[model samples]
Target: MASESPEMNRLHPFSAVTTTLNRGIVGLSVPFFLIGVLSSVTDAVDPVWSIYLAPIGLVAGVAYGLTYYYRFEYALTQDTFDLSSGVFSRRSREIPFRRIQNVDVRQGLVQQLLGVAVVTIETAGGGDTEAQLNFVSEDEANRLQREIRRLTAAANGERSATEAETASSDEDEDEEATSNETADLETAATPERHSDPGVSEDERHEQPVDHGEPTRLFELSSRELGLYSFTSFSFAAVGGVLFLLLFANDAIFGLLISMAEPLGGPANLDSASPLEYGVFGIISLVNGLALTYLFSVVYTFLGYYGFQVGRAGEDLVYERGLLQRYSGSIPLEKVQSLTVSDNPLQRQIGYAGLWIETAGYGPDSGGGSQSAIPLARKRRVYGFAERLSGLERPSFRRPTTVARRRYLGRYSIIAGVVVAGAFGLSLVTAVENWWLAAVVFLAVPPAAHLRWVNLGYYVGEDNLVIRSGFWKRRTTVVPYYRLQTVSTRRSIFQRRLGLASLVVDTASSRTFFWATPTIYDLEYEVAREINETTRQRLQSALRERARSSDSEDGDAGVSVAFT
Candidate 1:
């Protein structure tokens, strides 16, 4: 790709588009922001002709300045990488080749149309001292990826020429071994045997090969993405609706104050003109469901809209974005675990979520790197994740939920606390309502019962799969290594019942409200079994790897030990 001068380069590459876009988007929401400001000013002023120009200008200027600072320049140097930007701070990021972990090339819709892709290089250490680049042509993207890979390999003292000759002769033998072995990765045979360094981005271009699958750059059916309005966080559509509805300032205020209470249930109840109430109920129910569906549609569109996923070399790449396109890639070897989820609804419909838990992408990520792929069949999830996970048997296990009776008792206690608190407060304050407490009491029993029935776990060779959710059920799998920590807890009631809750914490932004409270008791024997087995397995694997390396060192006649 031809290099563009900074003066004319409008496309943001190696720049903070997220930060710039944040400013622009927020600045553009002036209409919404102004409404509140104008209303408050108008109420305070006698002459409404007076304006608040200073505040308006100040807000826009600050946002613009923020956006400007976010632009940057990044380049891959001969032996090191560097990134420079920041409006006032003018900070520069430079790192040696050894610090780089992985390189990614991503292309979103607009980028694809423009024949451009963003190349990202990530490292494991903390602090904002790493390099990040944003926009480059597809040619440059490939070139940059190879450059980083070459430098990183060289830094590790990789003997590429020797490794290549050895790998070429080993390939046939490895293929034969693959036939005999039950499992072996496709990549293991090739080992990325390449000898080119200092190759230009344009020179690195290679013709693409067919993968024999439906090479869908974009995957979505009209009914699935549009009609169902589904997303990774299913039923989270409600939160989006509530956010929009919060702009329903009138409604929010009505709720906040006791103003809506004396409206006497809006004449929609059965007792107040039964026919009218029935008609209203029909209308209200439809409206509520439609409103709920709206959330699904918006989430599906904004987050996963224009989603495109495909394989690039040995990596699985996914690109999705609406106003701003985002593309990311994951190396197969970096992946630590694979998770599959299916709700009753999803099972009936034949669609499941495929998730990859990668060590690079935080093995502790509970949901793993996800794909919006519609692998509906049970066999399909296994078939795909197995291939995606290099054909390893995923440790598939269902999460255990405490029995219905146990949950019921817990809910009963929660309900009693809420009810008693409300009942006592109502008498003393005359401000609190006892009816809300009654609804809580009625609701807890069935919700708890449903929760218990829905909870289950599946244990596979390498992953533990968890399935739960009442209405819009969700199943997620988390590997034992993905766990940051694990603990057990039990209430007095649970102690009496001879059950304890096992909680596994993964590093995720996903809330643990529904997740942590559940994770019912695994017997001491079962808990010990899992811990000991994994611990021993990990130890044996590490020792085996060490032994192999030692043999390699011995073959090279390298002496170390006490020397």
Candidate 2:
């Protein structure tokens, strides 16, 4: 066990009380639920005994909380953040400053009431939070965030200086051995340096002057939030409500019928005409959908209330949420890709959202990809993406006509199956308008054509752009150096159609549930060629970046020596 020093800090004393309450609620729930079940099933467990479980659990929780509070200690060392925790078994962890990617502060309702917050530290290549302080003074949390950022910046600066010195030493030795040859090499490289198209805007402006003040990039207004909520309707919310209704249908219908009887409503649905049934079903569905939409609107409002994003030195900082506040920073150096996304409705309205993916951050750590701008105009989003990624908007190449044929065949088969099913049902039932379902066939051609038109890929000088998805179109921009793996995959159906998908994997690509950055339904040969070309370009980009860094380091060293 490590002895406590002046540098070591413990959580706020009130953490014991909050921890007790949190644990007590959880501990009491299980026993009370079990007691209720046992009392209903048998006479062995009395319902009155459930009342005693609360105090017992509370006492146990208080004891555990006290122990845990005493056992936990943390300290900030020069190069690492050290933690000592565990009540029953001792465990210690040291997280290096270089590995830390983000330091986020979050406060739930209970914590807010208590005037404390949870501080989570995310590290490189980890799916979950590397370390968390459950309950700390809000001031302490802020201080910790600032301290981590300062330390990380200082560490990185020192590393860069050391590398520059080393590179300068190596260059000096090379010049001494071949001074004439080095002079000739420099002459040959001068023109190539000026005309290198592979050099990115970021490389040109490697380090921007920092004023120590955050630059606000975007903010969400109430009107725009509402518009975004309504346009980005979540079918998942509707499905959840439907799922709940399925299991509680009997009780829900009985209550509804009882309420209707008071108003002298229809006594039996069985005696209604087919037309009446259709009207009733439509009314119910419309009502359900309206309720679902309202729920989604409220959910979105709560989640994104007072949302804002800004650039703070080398980090992108964001703060959001109404009830559970979240404030976090994303290290710009770790960013892997940027995505501009919009639904068909939003696209028509000229609005979109921007999302950023960073290494070691995902759904398990609060959210999959952080939203740089939750809602904005399409042009504003594109401009922001280009500025952050250092790449211009790309001109996309549409898939070949063969890919369009595949989509047509696919949607047509789906329409055929649905129409056939409806016709078969009409033969067995008294319904007369089953042929109306054939109208689905009328949509197949347009739907297939729209899907093809929306799918495209562009290989830029320093980045790869992929645009896909019909319902929620996303234009993903992945820089060449950020690309982890590039491959061509052919599904069984795609193989039959002689088509393949080019998949570009990055550090954060696998974190989301949707497909990675992919160009789907391309010619097999074309996909293979793209795959190989992307790999070669990735290698070249890395080499170019390395040379650029070395040249910068040498220049710095020369200036310092001259001074």
Give per-candidate clash totals: 20, 0
TM-score winner: 2
lDDT of 2 by residue, 165-226 (tens): 65444433533322232233234334433454433343333222332445555678787788
- Candidate RMSDs in Å, in order, are 11.0, 8.2
Name the best candidate (by lDDT). Answer: 2
| Reference-based lDDT, each prediction | 0.50, 0.74
| Candidate 1, 1-563: lDDT as tens digits | 11322322223433344555565566545544665567776775333322354345446755774556444556656556766666657776677776554465556667678777766666545423145555676776666665555454343333322433444434344333322321123223222212223222432332233222213322544545553345334457787666766676755434423322243333323245544554555655555567777667675666556665654433455666575555555544345445566555666666565655443332113233445354334554555554443334434343344456776777888888888888888888855668677777678777787787766655544445555676555555554434555666666766666666566555432343334323565554465565555455445545544564444332211111100
**What lDDT score is found at residue 274 in candidate 1?**
45
Backbone clashes (count) for model 1: 20
What TM-score, over all chains together, does every model reach? Answer: 0.60, 0.80
Candidate 1: residue 358 Cα off by (Å): 3.8
